[model samples]
Target chain A: MDRTIAIDVSHLSKTYDSYRAVDDLSFQVYAGEIFGLLGPNGAGKSTTLRTLITLLHPTSGAATVMGYDTVRDADKVRTLIGYVPQERAIDRFLTGREHLQLLGALYHLTKEEAAKRIAKLLTLVELEAHADRPAKTYSGGMKRKLDIACGLLPDPKVLFLDEPTLGLDVQSRLRIWEYVRMLKARGMTIVMTTNYLDEADQLCDRLAIIDGGKIKTLGSPVELKIALGGDIVSLTLKETDRIHSLESELKDRPAIKAVRATTKGLDIRVESPEKALPTILESANRLGCNIEFIQYNRPRLDDVFIAHTGRAITESIPESETA
Target chain B: MAHYWQEISALTMRWVRRLSREKFSMLFTLVQPMLFWLIFFGNLFQRAADTQVMQAPNYISFLAAGVVVMTVLNNGLAGGVDLLFDKENGFLERLMSTPIHRTSVILSRFIFVMGITSMQVLVILGVAYLFGVQPATGILGVAMIVLIGMMFGIGLTAISMAMAFSVKSHGDFFSVLGFLSLPMIFLSSALVPLTAMPGWMSFLAQFNPMTWAIDAVRPLILSGWTEALPHVGMVVLVMLVFDALCLYGGAKAFRRAMG
Candidate 1:
């Protein structure tokens, strides 16, 4: 990658009345990289994307897309970016083809150019067969495909997708992931937000784990997992009240990196599970806490989230926050 | 400037296409005004109303102008329903995020409503012809009536769009729409002549724009160009000021919603 910055957000903050939706945040998205904002609902992911797309004005600070200031040169910035919002924006009364045709006109394409581009995009999203059907008849997956096709109408340099695979079936999600990778192959910079762990791990080149409208940590999935040291040993104990005692005992070991108590029990991060397994068993036996279940595995993104925010991402935030 | 109009035309065509696809709505929108107001109510009141007081050949001929202007008022006030739906569904956000001029959205809606209002006015005139009501000003005068209807619609539609942007929900918008349309129609000379109206209603009707529009259109249908021209000029001047205030409020509401 040439490391050209496609987007630069500096101290971007947005507030609704007294509630701060997006705090003073800063980040840079490199050209041709699929950057993901991984957070639970209401963690400021959509607000961040909306600001970058110029759908909103920031309360303070600034952002730029392709060097055009989002606030100052909004029209120029709009020419370079496409946004797919979290809500389904399809007009149920309009056919799939009509939607694209209208979008083409908004983008200022000539009649012939719009027709040609619409045909190509319909084929790309595999909606050509049902192009004449009203969007109300489309399935959930098909509607999302149409939304993606509409976003691609401008041949935008950057695409902002808010929860691209949200409410999608497994097959539809896999197909959307394939399409996203195809776009990245064509060198389009994609910035997507998702609360799904597997989506962030499988699709994003790098992600920022966010909480309470703040970025808890930021890195590639592999780098974040590796940063947790070696392996995670999760143990379920019968004597749940004595769990804190085991954490203190495990914390004294030089080989142990960190220990966290979850609903499932204690998760101990160790340099080597093989060397630390026997010590763990002996400590449990000495403490008279019966180990009902135990397992060891390489660090996953869940552990990475747990390591930074001190809680699992899925259970960390309430779902009441508007996406 | 060319690109701006092009975007507006594209958006206008979108509304045109959507309405065309609704086979039921298109049929009813044209038919309902004539069926209820012109044929049924016009005949029902044929014996009750004094044609001499109306200064026309019959009640229906005098009522013809009322129905025409009434169509413009109803269509214009209901114009923003589609936009309110678009806002709620997030399609408005999608359009705003595009590179097109923001004002094009409002202008395109204005064109679409006026086009439909013009079509309904023609249909109402045709139905009135079947009932032995002819415009004394002839074909050119009929064209003028449509133009006047569109001019009056421009102001009502602007106010409707402002309400759409200002209200929090469709429920509130509908409430406001109902509140404005029924009262405006009753206070005007649509259902009855100003000479036959109650003293207080006649006084209120003088201040109503609907009354100005109806009064302007009635002369074109019942009297010749000599009688119609003066009323036309007066309504035109009144509409210019009405539209200015409406568009100003509409633009302010649009800016606030966008922000």
Candidate 2:
């Protein structure tokens, strides 16, 4: 299927004083697609998003949103996009309904239009019961939901969410994911940045694995994993025979692609774990090696990230958030 | 143009709502100056203040104009606190990301501060009336005083907002505010006539925009419009130059910060 580009960034770079935050980067976001910039903290994901939103000017190159230049036609670009920043931006004193009303007014929505949109958004975000209460009294989840509702106020052509669920609880994170999917269902193009492995894999239709101010790799989650192109079989052998002989035997097997010795045991790469596991066991049996433990699984997005960046993304994920 | 008004009014109403919600602060913003300056301090020096040098019926009458302009100075100098808080809290960034006219952010703040300054001015006038003081130029003169207070406020508020955008944090902004407010009040004619102050102090007072504002307002309360109009005209000219410089600095700082 042919898709029109909603956002095009060409060789964009942003430098702050002596440090380059984003170096020579280029990508395109298609219409009606949920695109994500997957990277660790200070990996330049937020800088790229800010440049596209016209908040920060790119030091070199340029970006366009809906064909409007982000720099030359910022006001025109601003009208077509909704941005929810990583930081919490809700006014503590204003009630949920009042926030939406104020944003509606700023968006130049008439009184009747603001009222209609406010009511619908309040209901949609499930904050109707607490709509009149001050935002200071809200939970973190409620606050994030309120921010999302605010972003949806303009019914924007593109929505930019910067770490939308960075500090949210599991329940709130799931709820946000649901809302993001619903927005996509309504044909709204979304650009989000996240460091979570599951968030990138589960939420993004296509994502760019950004690292050190550049695109390390970019593709659908499935395509990236398939590009790794094999299942991994990990084995821990009991102390009964020569591990080197077992490794050599597995290396000669046609089903096994490669074999490398790990501290615990052997890590063997193969086309199909189901077909290769029996052949490896037979070779180990011939060598009189007792298999204490064995585990086999398909390559995950983490593996794909490691393949491109040579570092596990799990290292950057917080302990509690690593599912 | 319609969009400008709509956005400014909407943003200004946000300030109004927030201010109204903080009942304690709202009450104190009006009553604090009145309690400390107009009633206690003014009456404390009622007997000590020389009427001939003041050229007024009494101390309270002369102090009324000082108190009104002083309130404008205090409120105006601190006008950017709310905007600074918005910046710190990240709401300013959100507003900037929207399609609204960016000038509306600064303009709305000006409108809100001036609105509150007008209310405070009226409250001080009403209280001064109870102390047996009245504007010599009557109702029109009273309106003129509020107008002057607002004019003086614009320059001070512009300076305050420039600091808000320029400073790295609220702590630094407060430090600068403390450094500025007391010296400005003391160096002006807010507390005493220029003749009563030392020669050097009076020389410095002449340079204070606050002094010009107070000098402009003193005649409206103690003398009539015939004596007051010239001072008003002079202060208006001074404030215009003052506001232009402040607003230019403010716009520069705003551009750098927003960028």
Best prediction by DockQ: 1
Where is model 2 chain A poorest over a 10-residue stretch in terms of lDDT? A314-323
Residues A1-323 of candidate 1: C-alpha lDDT, one tens digit per residue: 46899999999888887788888888888999999998877889888888888878899989999999999999999999988877789988899999999999899999999999999999999999999999999999999999999999999999999999999999999999999999999999999999899999999999998777778888899999988788999999998998989988888687788888877579999999878988899988999989999999899998887788777766856544642
Query: Would you estimate the TM-scores of all the predictions?
Result: 0.90, 0.87
Quality of candidate 2's docking, in CAPRI categories? medium
Candidate 1 interface RMSD after superposing interface residues: 0.9
Q: Assess the local accuracy of residue B229 in candidate 1 as a C-alpha lDDT between 0 and 100.
A: 91
Model 1 per-residue lDDT at A49: 86
Global CA lDDT of candidate 2, please? 0.88
Tens digits of per-residue lDDT for model 1, B91-160: 9989988998978898899989998888888888898898998889999999999988888899889889
User: Which regions of candidate 1 are displaced past 4 Å?
Assistant: A229-231, A237-290, A306-312, A316-323, B33-35, B52-57, B194-203
